[model samples]
Each structure stands twice: as structure tokens, then as C-alpha cells.
Target: MSNDHRRLGRELDLFDSDPLVGAGLPLWLPGGAAARHEVESYLYELERRAGYQHVYSPALGKRRMYEMSGHWHNFADDMFPPMRIGDDELVLRPSMCPHHALIFKARGRSYRDLPLRIAELGQMYRAERSGVLGGLSRVRSIALNDAHIFCPEDQASAEVAGVLRLMREAHEALGMGEVSYQLSLRGPGGKYGGDDASWVRSEELLRGALSKAKISYADARGEAAFYGPKIDVLVADPAGRSWAMSTIQIDYHQPERFNLEFAGADGRRHRPVMVHRSLAGSMERLFGHLIEVHAGAFPVWYSPVQLAVLPVGADQDDAASSFAADALAAGLRAESVHDGSIGARIRDAAGRKIPYIGMIGSREAPDGLVALRLRDGRQLDPMPQAEAIALIASIAAARSQELLP
Candidate 1:
């Protein structure tokens, strides 16, 4: 296993999980939070463009709610111990499906609202074993990049296709390599929540969608949730290690279990099917994998500190600060460090895997330029301030993994 993430995370000042704050609960430092903010922003825009409306729910909920959704009974061992509050047992939510289902049930729906795509970067808590807790990859508290699509049975497959497209686009953008699919179906004679017909229909719907989407998959019997069948997207890291990072599940049971109803074309009530998706899976785990995949050298747009300004001498300190300010105004994350020698500053920034470094000195300051250094050891000698800022800004705007030529 790559233990480099821990060292890299510390060197980058990314995140920390203090025993005082409770194990498996990571505290995102400023640097880590900056990266997370960018991730969340990108996902919000992506999901919105795909017709997903965002929603919010409490982090903890009454146990009765989970009981109704069957999560309390099916996965109780994975949940935190309940706390009594005003005649109700409340626990931290291990998933967001129950809350979202309740939201769908809050008001009567029509066929027009058949495909309501609800999304949230919801916080969840799981009681992971202490021995298995390793940084952000395995955490008790996580922010799931989760969504639920409620549609009629006829529309479920089409909705799933849209989700598959989103998944492909996201993985490509993040540069995740080839993804394999696992179609998890119920085993023969296993006790499932829904009727046999519903289970068979749900399985066919998911399989049909995957086929329509032209995604080849392997069948995994007995790998499904109690409520339904699902497709798990597996991605391999740079080291050829695979992780189940994304999922799409077709669920007929939850809607029926909750008695969720919608009006059909004939003006009769019908149960809407629920398709669950988590494109990036847990944000924490995805972030952890990203940290390892990039080997701490995040892409320019995703880097917490996009540019670092170092002053070669005391005379250039003020100029360095001004240069950093200019870069920041240009929508670049830039900072000036004058406390150490230029060599030391550069080394520190490089250790943190900063993408670009700018050295200001008496020579460069007089010409109003900076000696630019790329992380890969390339140098641009004394480039004009405007040109440097423009280069960095345009590359960031492109979200390119490579440096501007």
C-alpha cells in the first residue's frame, strides 16, 4: 500500500485527523479546504448542467426515519450508536437516501415531475473499524457526492444513461483511466426486500441502460444491496490499483417501502422508481486517491497554491508581495514568502508540490519581471509580469493538466 499519502498530506498541509477530535474525523486545513472547495464547485456546476437540483438535509436524523427506509435494520452495525432525544433515537446518517426519499414524499407529485433529480454533497458518518482507519480514504465522517433520481419505471433507464454520461465526463476530466463496470445483482434464493417481479424488472432496467450506454460489464451475483441491483464503477490508480469510486443503483424497494406516490397519466397514484448515484463516491476517499494518483503534484487549477513567489533579497520583498497580489487578482492562488533564502523558499514550495514558482530579485525587480520556474525543473528567464500571469491564468482556465507552452 502507498503510505506516501500521509507524508504528502502533512507536507502539503492538506488535512489532519486528531485523536482529540476523534479518530477517522479529518480536519481540513486551509490548503485542503481550498482544494475541496474547487472540487465541490466543479461538481455543483456539472450536476446542475445535467439537470440535478441541489438539496440539503440534517446530518443526524431520528432512527425511526431510517427504520422506515430499512437502513436501520439492514445496516445497523455500520451506524453509530443512537442517542436518545425527546422520545426518539437519533443517529448520524450513514447515507443520504432516506432523507432524500422523505423530501420526495413531502409533497404530492405528478407524472410531469417523474424524473426529479435531487443532489447533495451530504455529510455522512459510518462506524468504520478502528484498525482500518487510514487517513481520509477510510473515515467515519464523509461528504458523499450523492444524488437520487425519482422517475417512472419507463424513464428510469434513460435517467441512468444520463448519469453514465456524467460519470464518463467527470472521470475523463479528472484524468482517471479506463473504468470497469460491475453489475451487482441479487443471488438466487436470497432474501430481498422487494417482490421477485420488481427485482427482476429493476435488474433488467439497469442491464438495459448499461447496454444502451455501450458500457461492458461483469455480473456479480450476490453483490447487490438488499433493496436493489447496482452498477459499480471501478477505476485504477497510477499504480494499477483499482478502487470502486462511483456507483449507480436502481431501487424499486425504497419508494414502495416509504409509500412514495406520484400521479400517473390516468390520474392514479403510482410508485416512482429511485435511481441512486454517487459519481465521485465519498469526497474524502476521492481526494485521498487523487492525492496519491497525482503523487502530490495536483493540476494547476486544483492545486491549493497555484503559484509561489520568492524574493531573492530583502530589496525585492515588497516587489514580491506586489507580484503575488497581481497574480491573485488574475484569479491565481499566489503567495509570497520572504522569510527564508530564495533556495530555501523554492525548496519548501517544491516540497509542497506547488505548480509554479516565481523568483523576484534585484535583477528581475528592476525590469518588473520574475524568474519563473516550473515544477518539472524547466525555467523561463525573466518573463514580463503580465505574460507570466496570463500564461498561468489561461492554463488554469483550461483546467489543463499540462503547463502552457
Candidate 2:
């Protein structure tokens, strides 16, 4: 592998794994944690605005839960071994949908609660062969921005349309506005659940939803989940590589198996249509794509350090510190480096893709001005500290990948 590809996670200080912990698990470093937090926060806000009620569930559940959800039959090979807890068997959750369904059952919902959207930043586990475990792209332990919507059968199309809207909004926020959609339908299968009618209706609803939204999508047969058909959103990277980042699936079998029902307007018990949607399919995969897409040069809004202040010499330390403080106060990520030469400092900042660099010296400090250098080394005329701070903050807010000059 080239240095650019191999050293991304290391250079960005995102994650690393060790043999002592076995394979497929990563130890996230501080920088990686910050990036994860920023993305999670963004998703939380977006989901909240869409009226999703956030929930949490345990990492392990009774094996019977998987059996009831039909994951044990079709997906058991990817799941970890069951644990013997006295008379009961437990296994780590491979997906959050089963647990979320239990929550709906716990409360016994009604038609008044139709279109109930519940979301969770769920940490899931799976057993993957060592060969497939790579950086963050493929891992054993993954976090999913998972959500489930329980809408009446008649309202399934509209609820799915809302999920598509949310998915598009998320992609645009992450600077992936060119994302495309794929409609993955079931093929003549042996492992998949449900009969012909179930698959047919689910596919029609998904197709109708996409058409009503006026979004263009491609169809792919035999790519659907064992229990449902789905629509996946694929994002194009800077290198023109495509990554499947999100999915919205319609499940007609699970609700019936779980005996989940809600009272309709006729005071009759009805099976609620279930939609499983994830804007960020798996945090691990998303992070891996991000590293490659930006080439480790994250946009200011996502950068751990958006700006770096480089002092010309030790004598300019105080001025550099002042500039850094101002930048931080204005909600711009900033750092100061006074131990290195001006050239070394510039090179370091450039290597890390820091969006803005401020140089402090006797000439600029005494006049309350700083020499601004962008990531590309283009020098901007010396400007007052406030203007520089404002410029950096604006760029960060706008999520501009290129530095302001």
C-alpha cells in the first residue's frame, strides 16, 4: 500500500488495533474520538429535528430475541457465539432493530402514535474473518446511527419518504451532496424470509416512495436484506470511489413474528409497518471513507485543529498565544507552536492540512496585526487579529475544505 493510504489513520491519529485485544477491534485515539463526536452530534441534531425519539439498549440480549427476529437462521454465521447465563443463552447484538422492536412492544402502542420514529446511536458487534478487518472500514465492533419508524401500512410510503429526506439532508451536511440512491430488491432466494406478496408490496412501496420524492435511483436485485427490501444511499468520494453509507429497509415479517400490534382507528389490532433507516450505516465504515475522501484533510468544521498559530521566534510567543486565544474564543479550533522555526512550523501545519496559519512577529505584533498563511502557502496581507479570527470562524462554519486567503 502507498504511504498516503496506509498512514491515514496513523497520521490523523484516528485508531489502531493490537494483537493483545484480538482482531477487528480498534482503540480510538483522541483525534478519532473528536471526529466521532462531531459526526454523532450532527446526526443527533438532525434526527431530533425530524422528531425521532432517541433510545438506548444493551449490547447483549437473549438468544431467543435473535431467533424471534429470524436473524439466528439467516445471520447467525456473522454473530458471536452464545453465552451460557445459567439456563438462558445470550449473544451480543448484531443489529439494533430487534431491540427497538422490543421497546415498541413494551409500551403497546396505538394508532395515535403512528409514524413513531425512534433513533439510537447503537453500538453493535459481529464476528468477521480476520482478512476482512481493516482500519475503520470493516470492524467487529461498530456504532450505527440506527432508527426505526412504525407507521401504519397505508402510511408506509410517506414515512419512507421522510427518511429519504433525512438521508439527503445528512449527506449534504457532510459535504456529500452528490450522493446517489440504490433500490436493492430481493431475488429468488432460499435464505430470505417472507413470501412473494410480502416482497412485492415492500418493493412497490420503496419504489413509490423514491418516485414521489422525485429522486433518481438505480435498482439492484438480490441485494436486499433477508427479511426486507431496502434503499441504500451511495456517496462518491473525492477519488470517485463510491461507498454505501446509509439504508432504509421495509420489514413486513418481523412485526408479525414478534406479535407486535397497534390499535387502529377502527379499534382493531393491526400490524404496524416497520422501516429501518440508518443515515450513517456504520460509524466504522463512514470513518474509513472519510479518511480516504478527504485524504486525511478534514474540513474545518470536522478538523480537530482548524487553525494553527506559529510564532516567528520565542520572542513572539505571547503574541501567538493571544492570537490562538482569539481564534478559540470565536469558536475556531486553534493551536500554537513556538518551538519550531517559521519554515518548520509552516510545513507542519501544511502536512496536517490546518486551514489557517497566523505568524506573529515584532513588526506584526506591535501593530496588533498577524501575517496569515493559508494551507497552500499563499500569503495574505497582514490583517488585524479580529478580522483573522472572523475569517477563520466563517470558513469553519461554512465547512470550507480550502483555507481562506
Specify the poorest-scoring 10-residue window by lDDT in model 2.
1-10
The residue-by-residue lDDT of candidate 1 on 1-405, one tens digit each, is: 443677678778999877799989999999989988887888889999988999999999998988888888778889999999888899999999999999999988999987999999989999999998877778899999999999998899899899999998887666555679999888887556878898899889988999998889999998888799999998665557667789999898899889999999998988899999988888888888788778878888788999999989998989999999999988889999988677888889888888899988888998899988999889888999989999998887777889765
TM-score of each: 0.95, 0.93
lDDT per model vs. reference: 0.87, 0.84
lDDT of 1: 0.87
Model 1 — which ten-residue stretch has the worst lDDT?
1-10
lDDT tens string, model 2, 215-280? Answer: 899998888998999999887644466667899999998998898999988999999989999987
Candidate 2 off by > 4 Å: 1-5, 235-242
- Which residue pairs clash in candidate 1? none
320 in model 1: Cα distance from truth in Å?
Answer: 1.0
Q: What is the lDDT of residue 24 in candidate 1?
A: 91
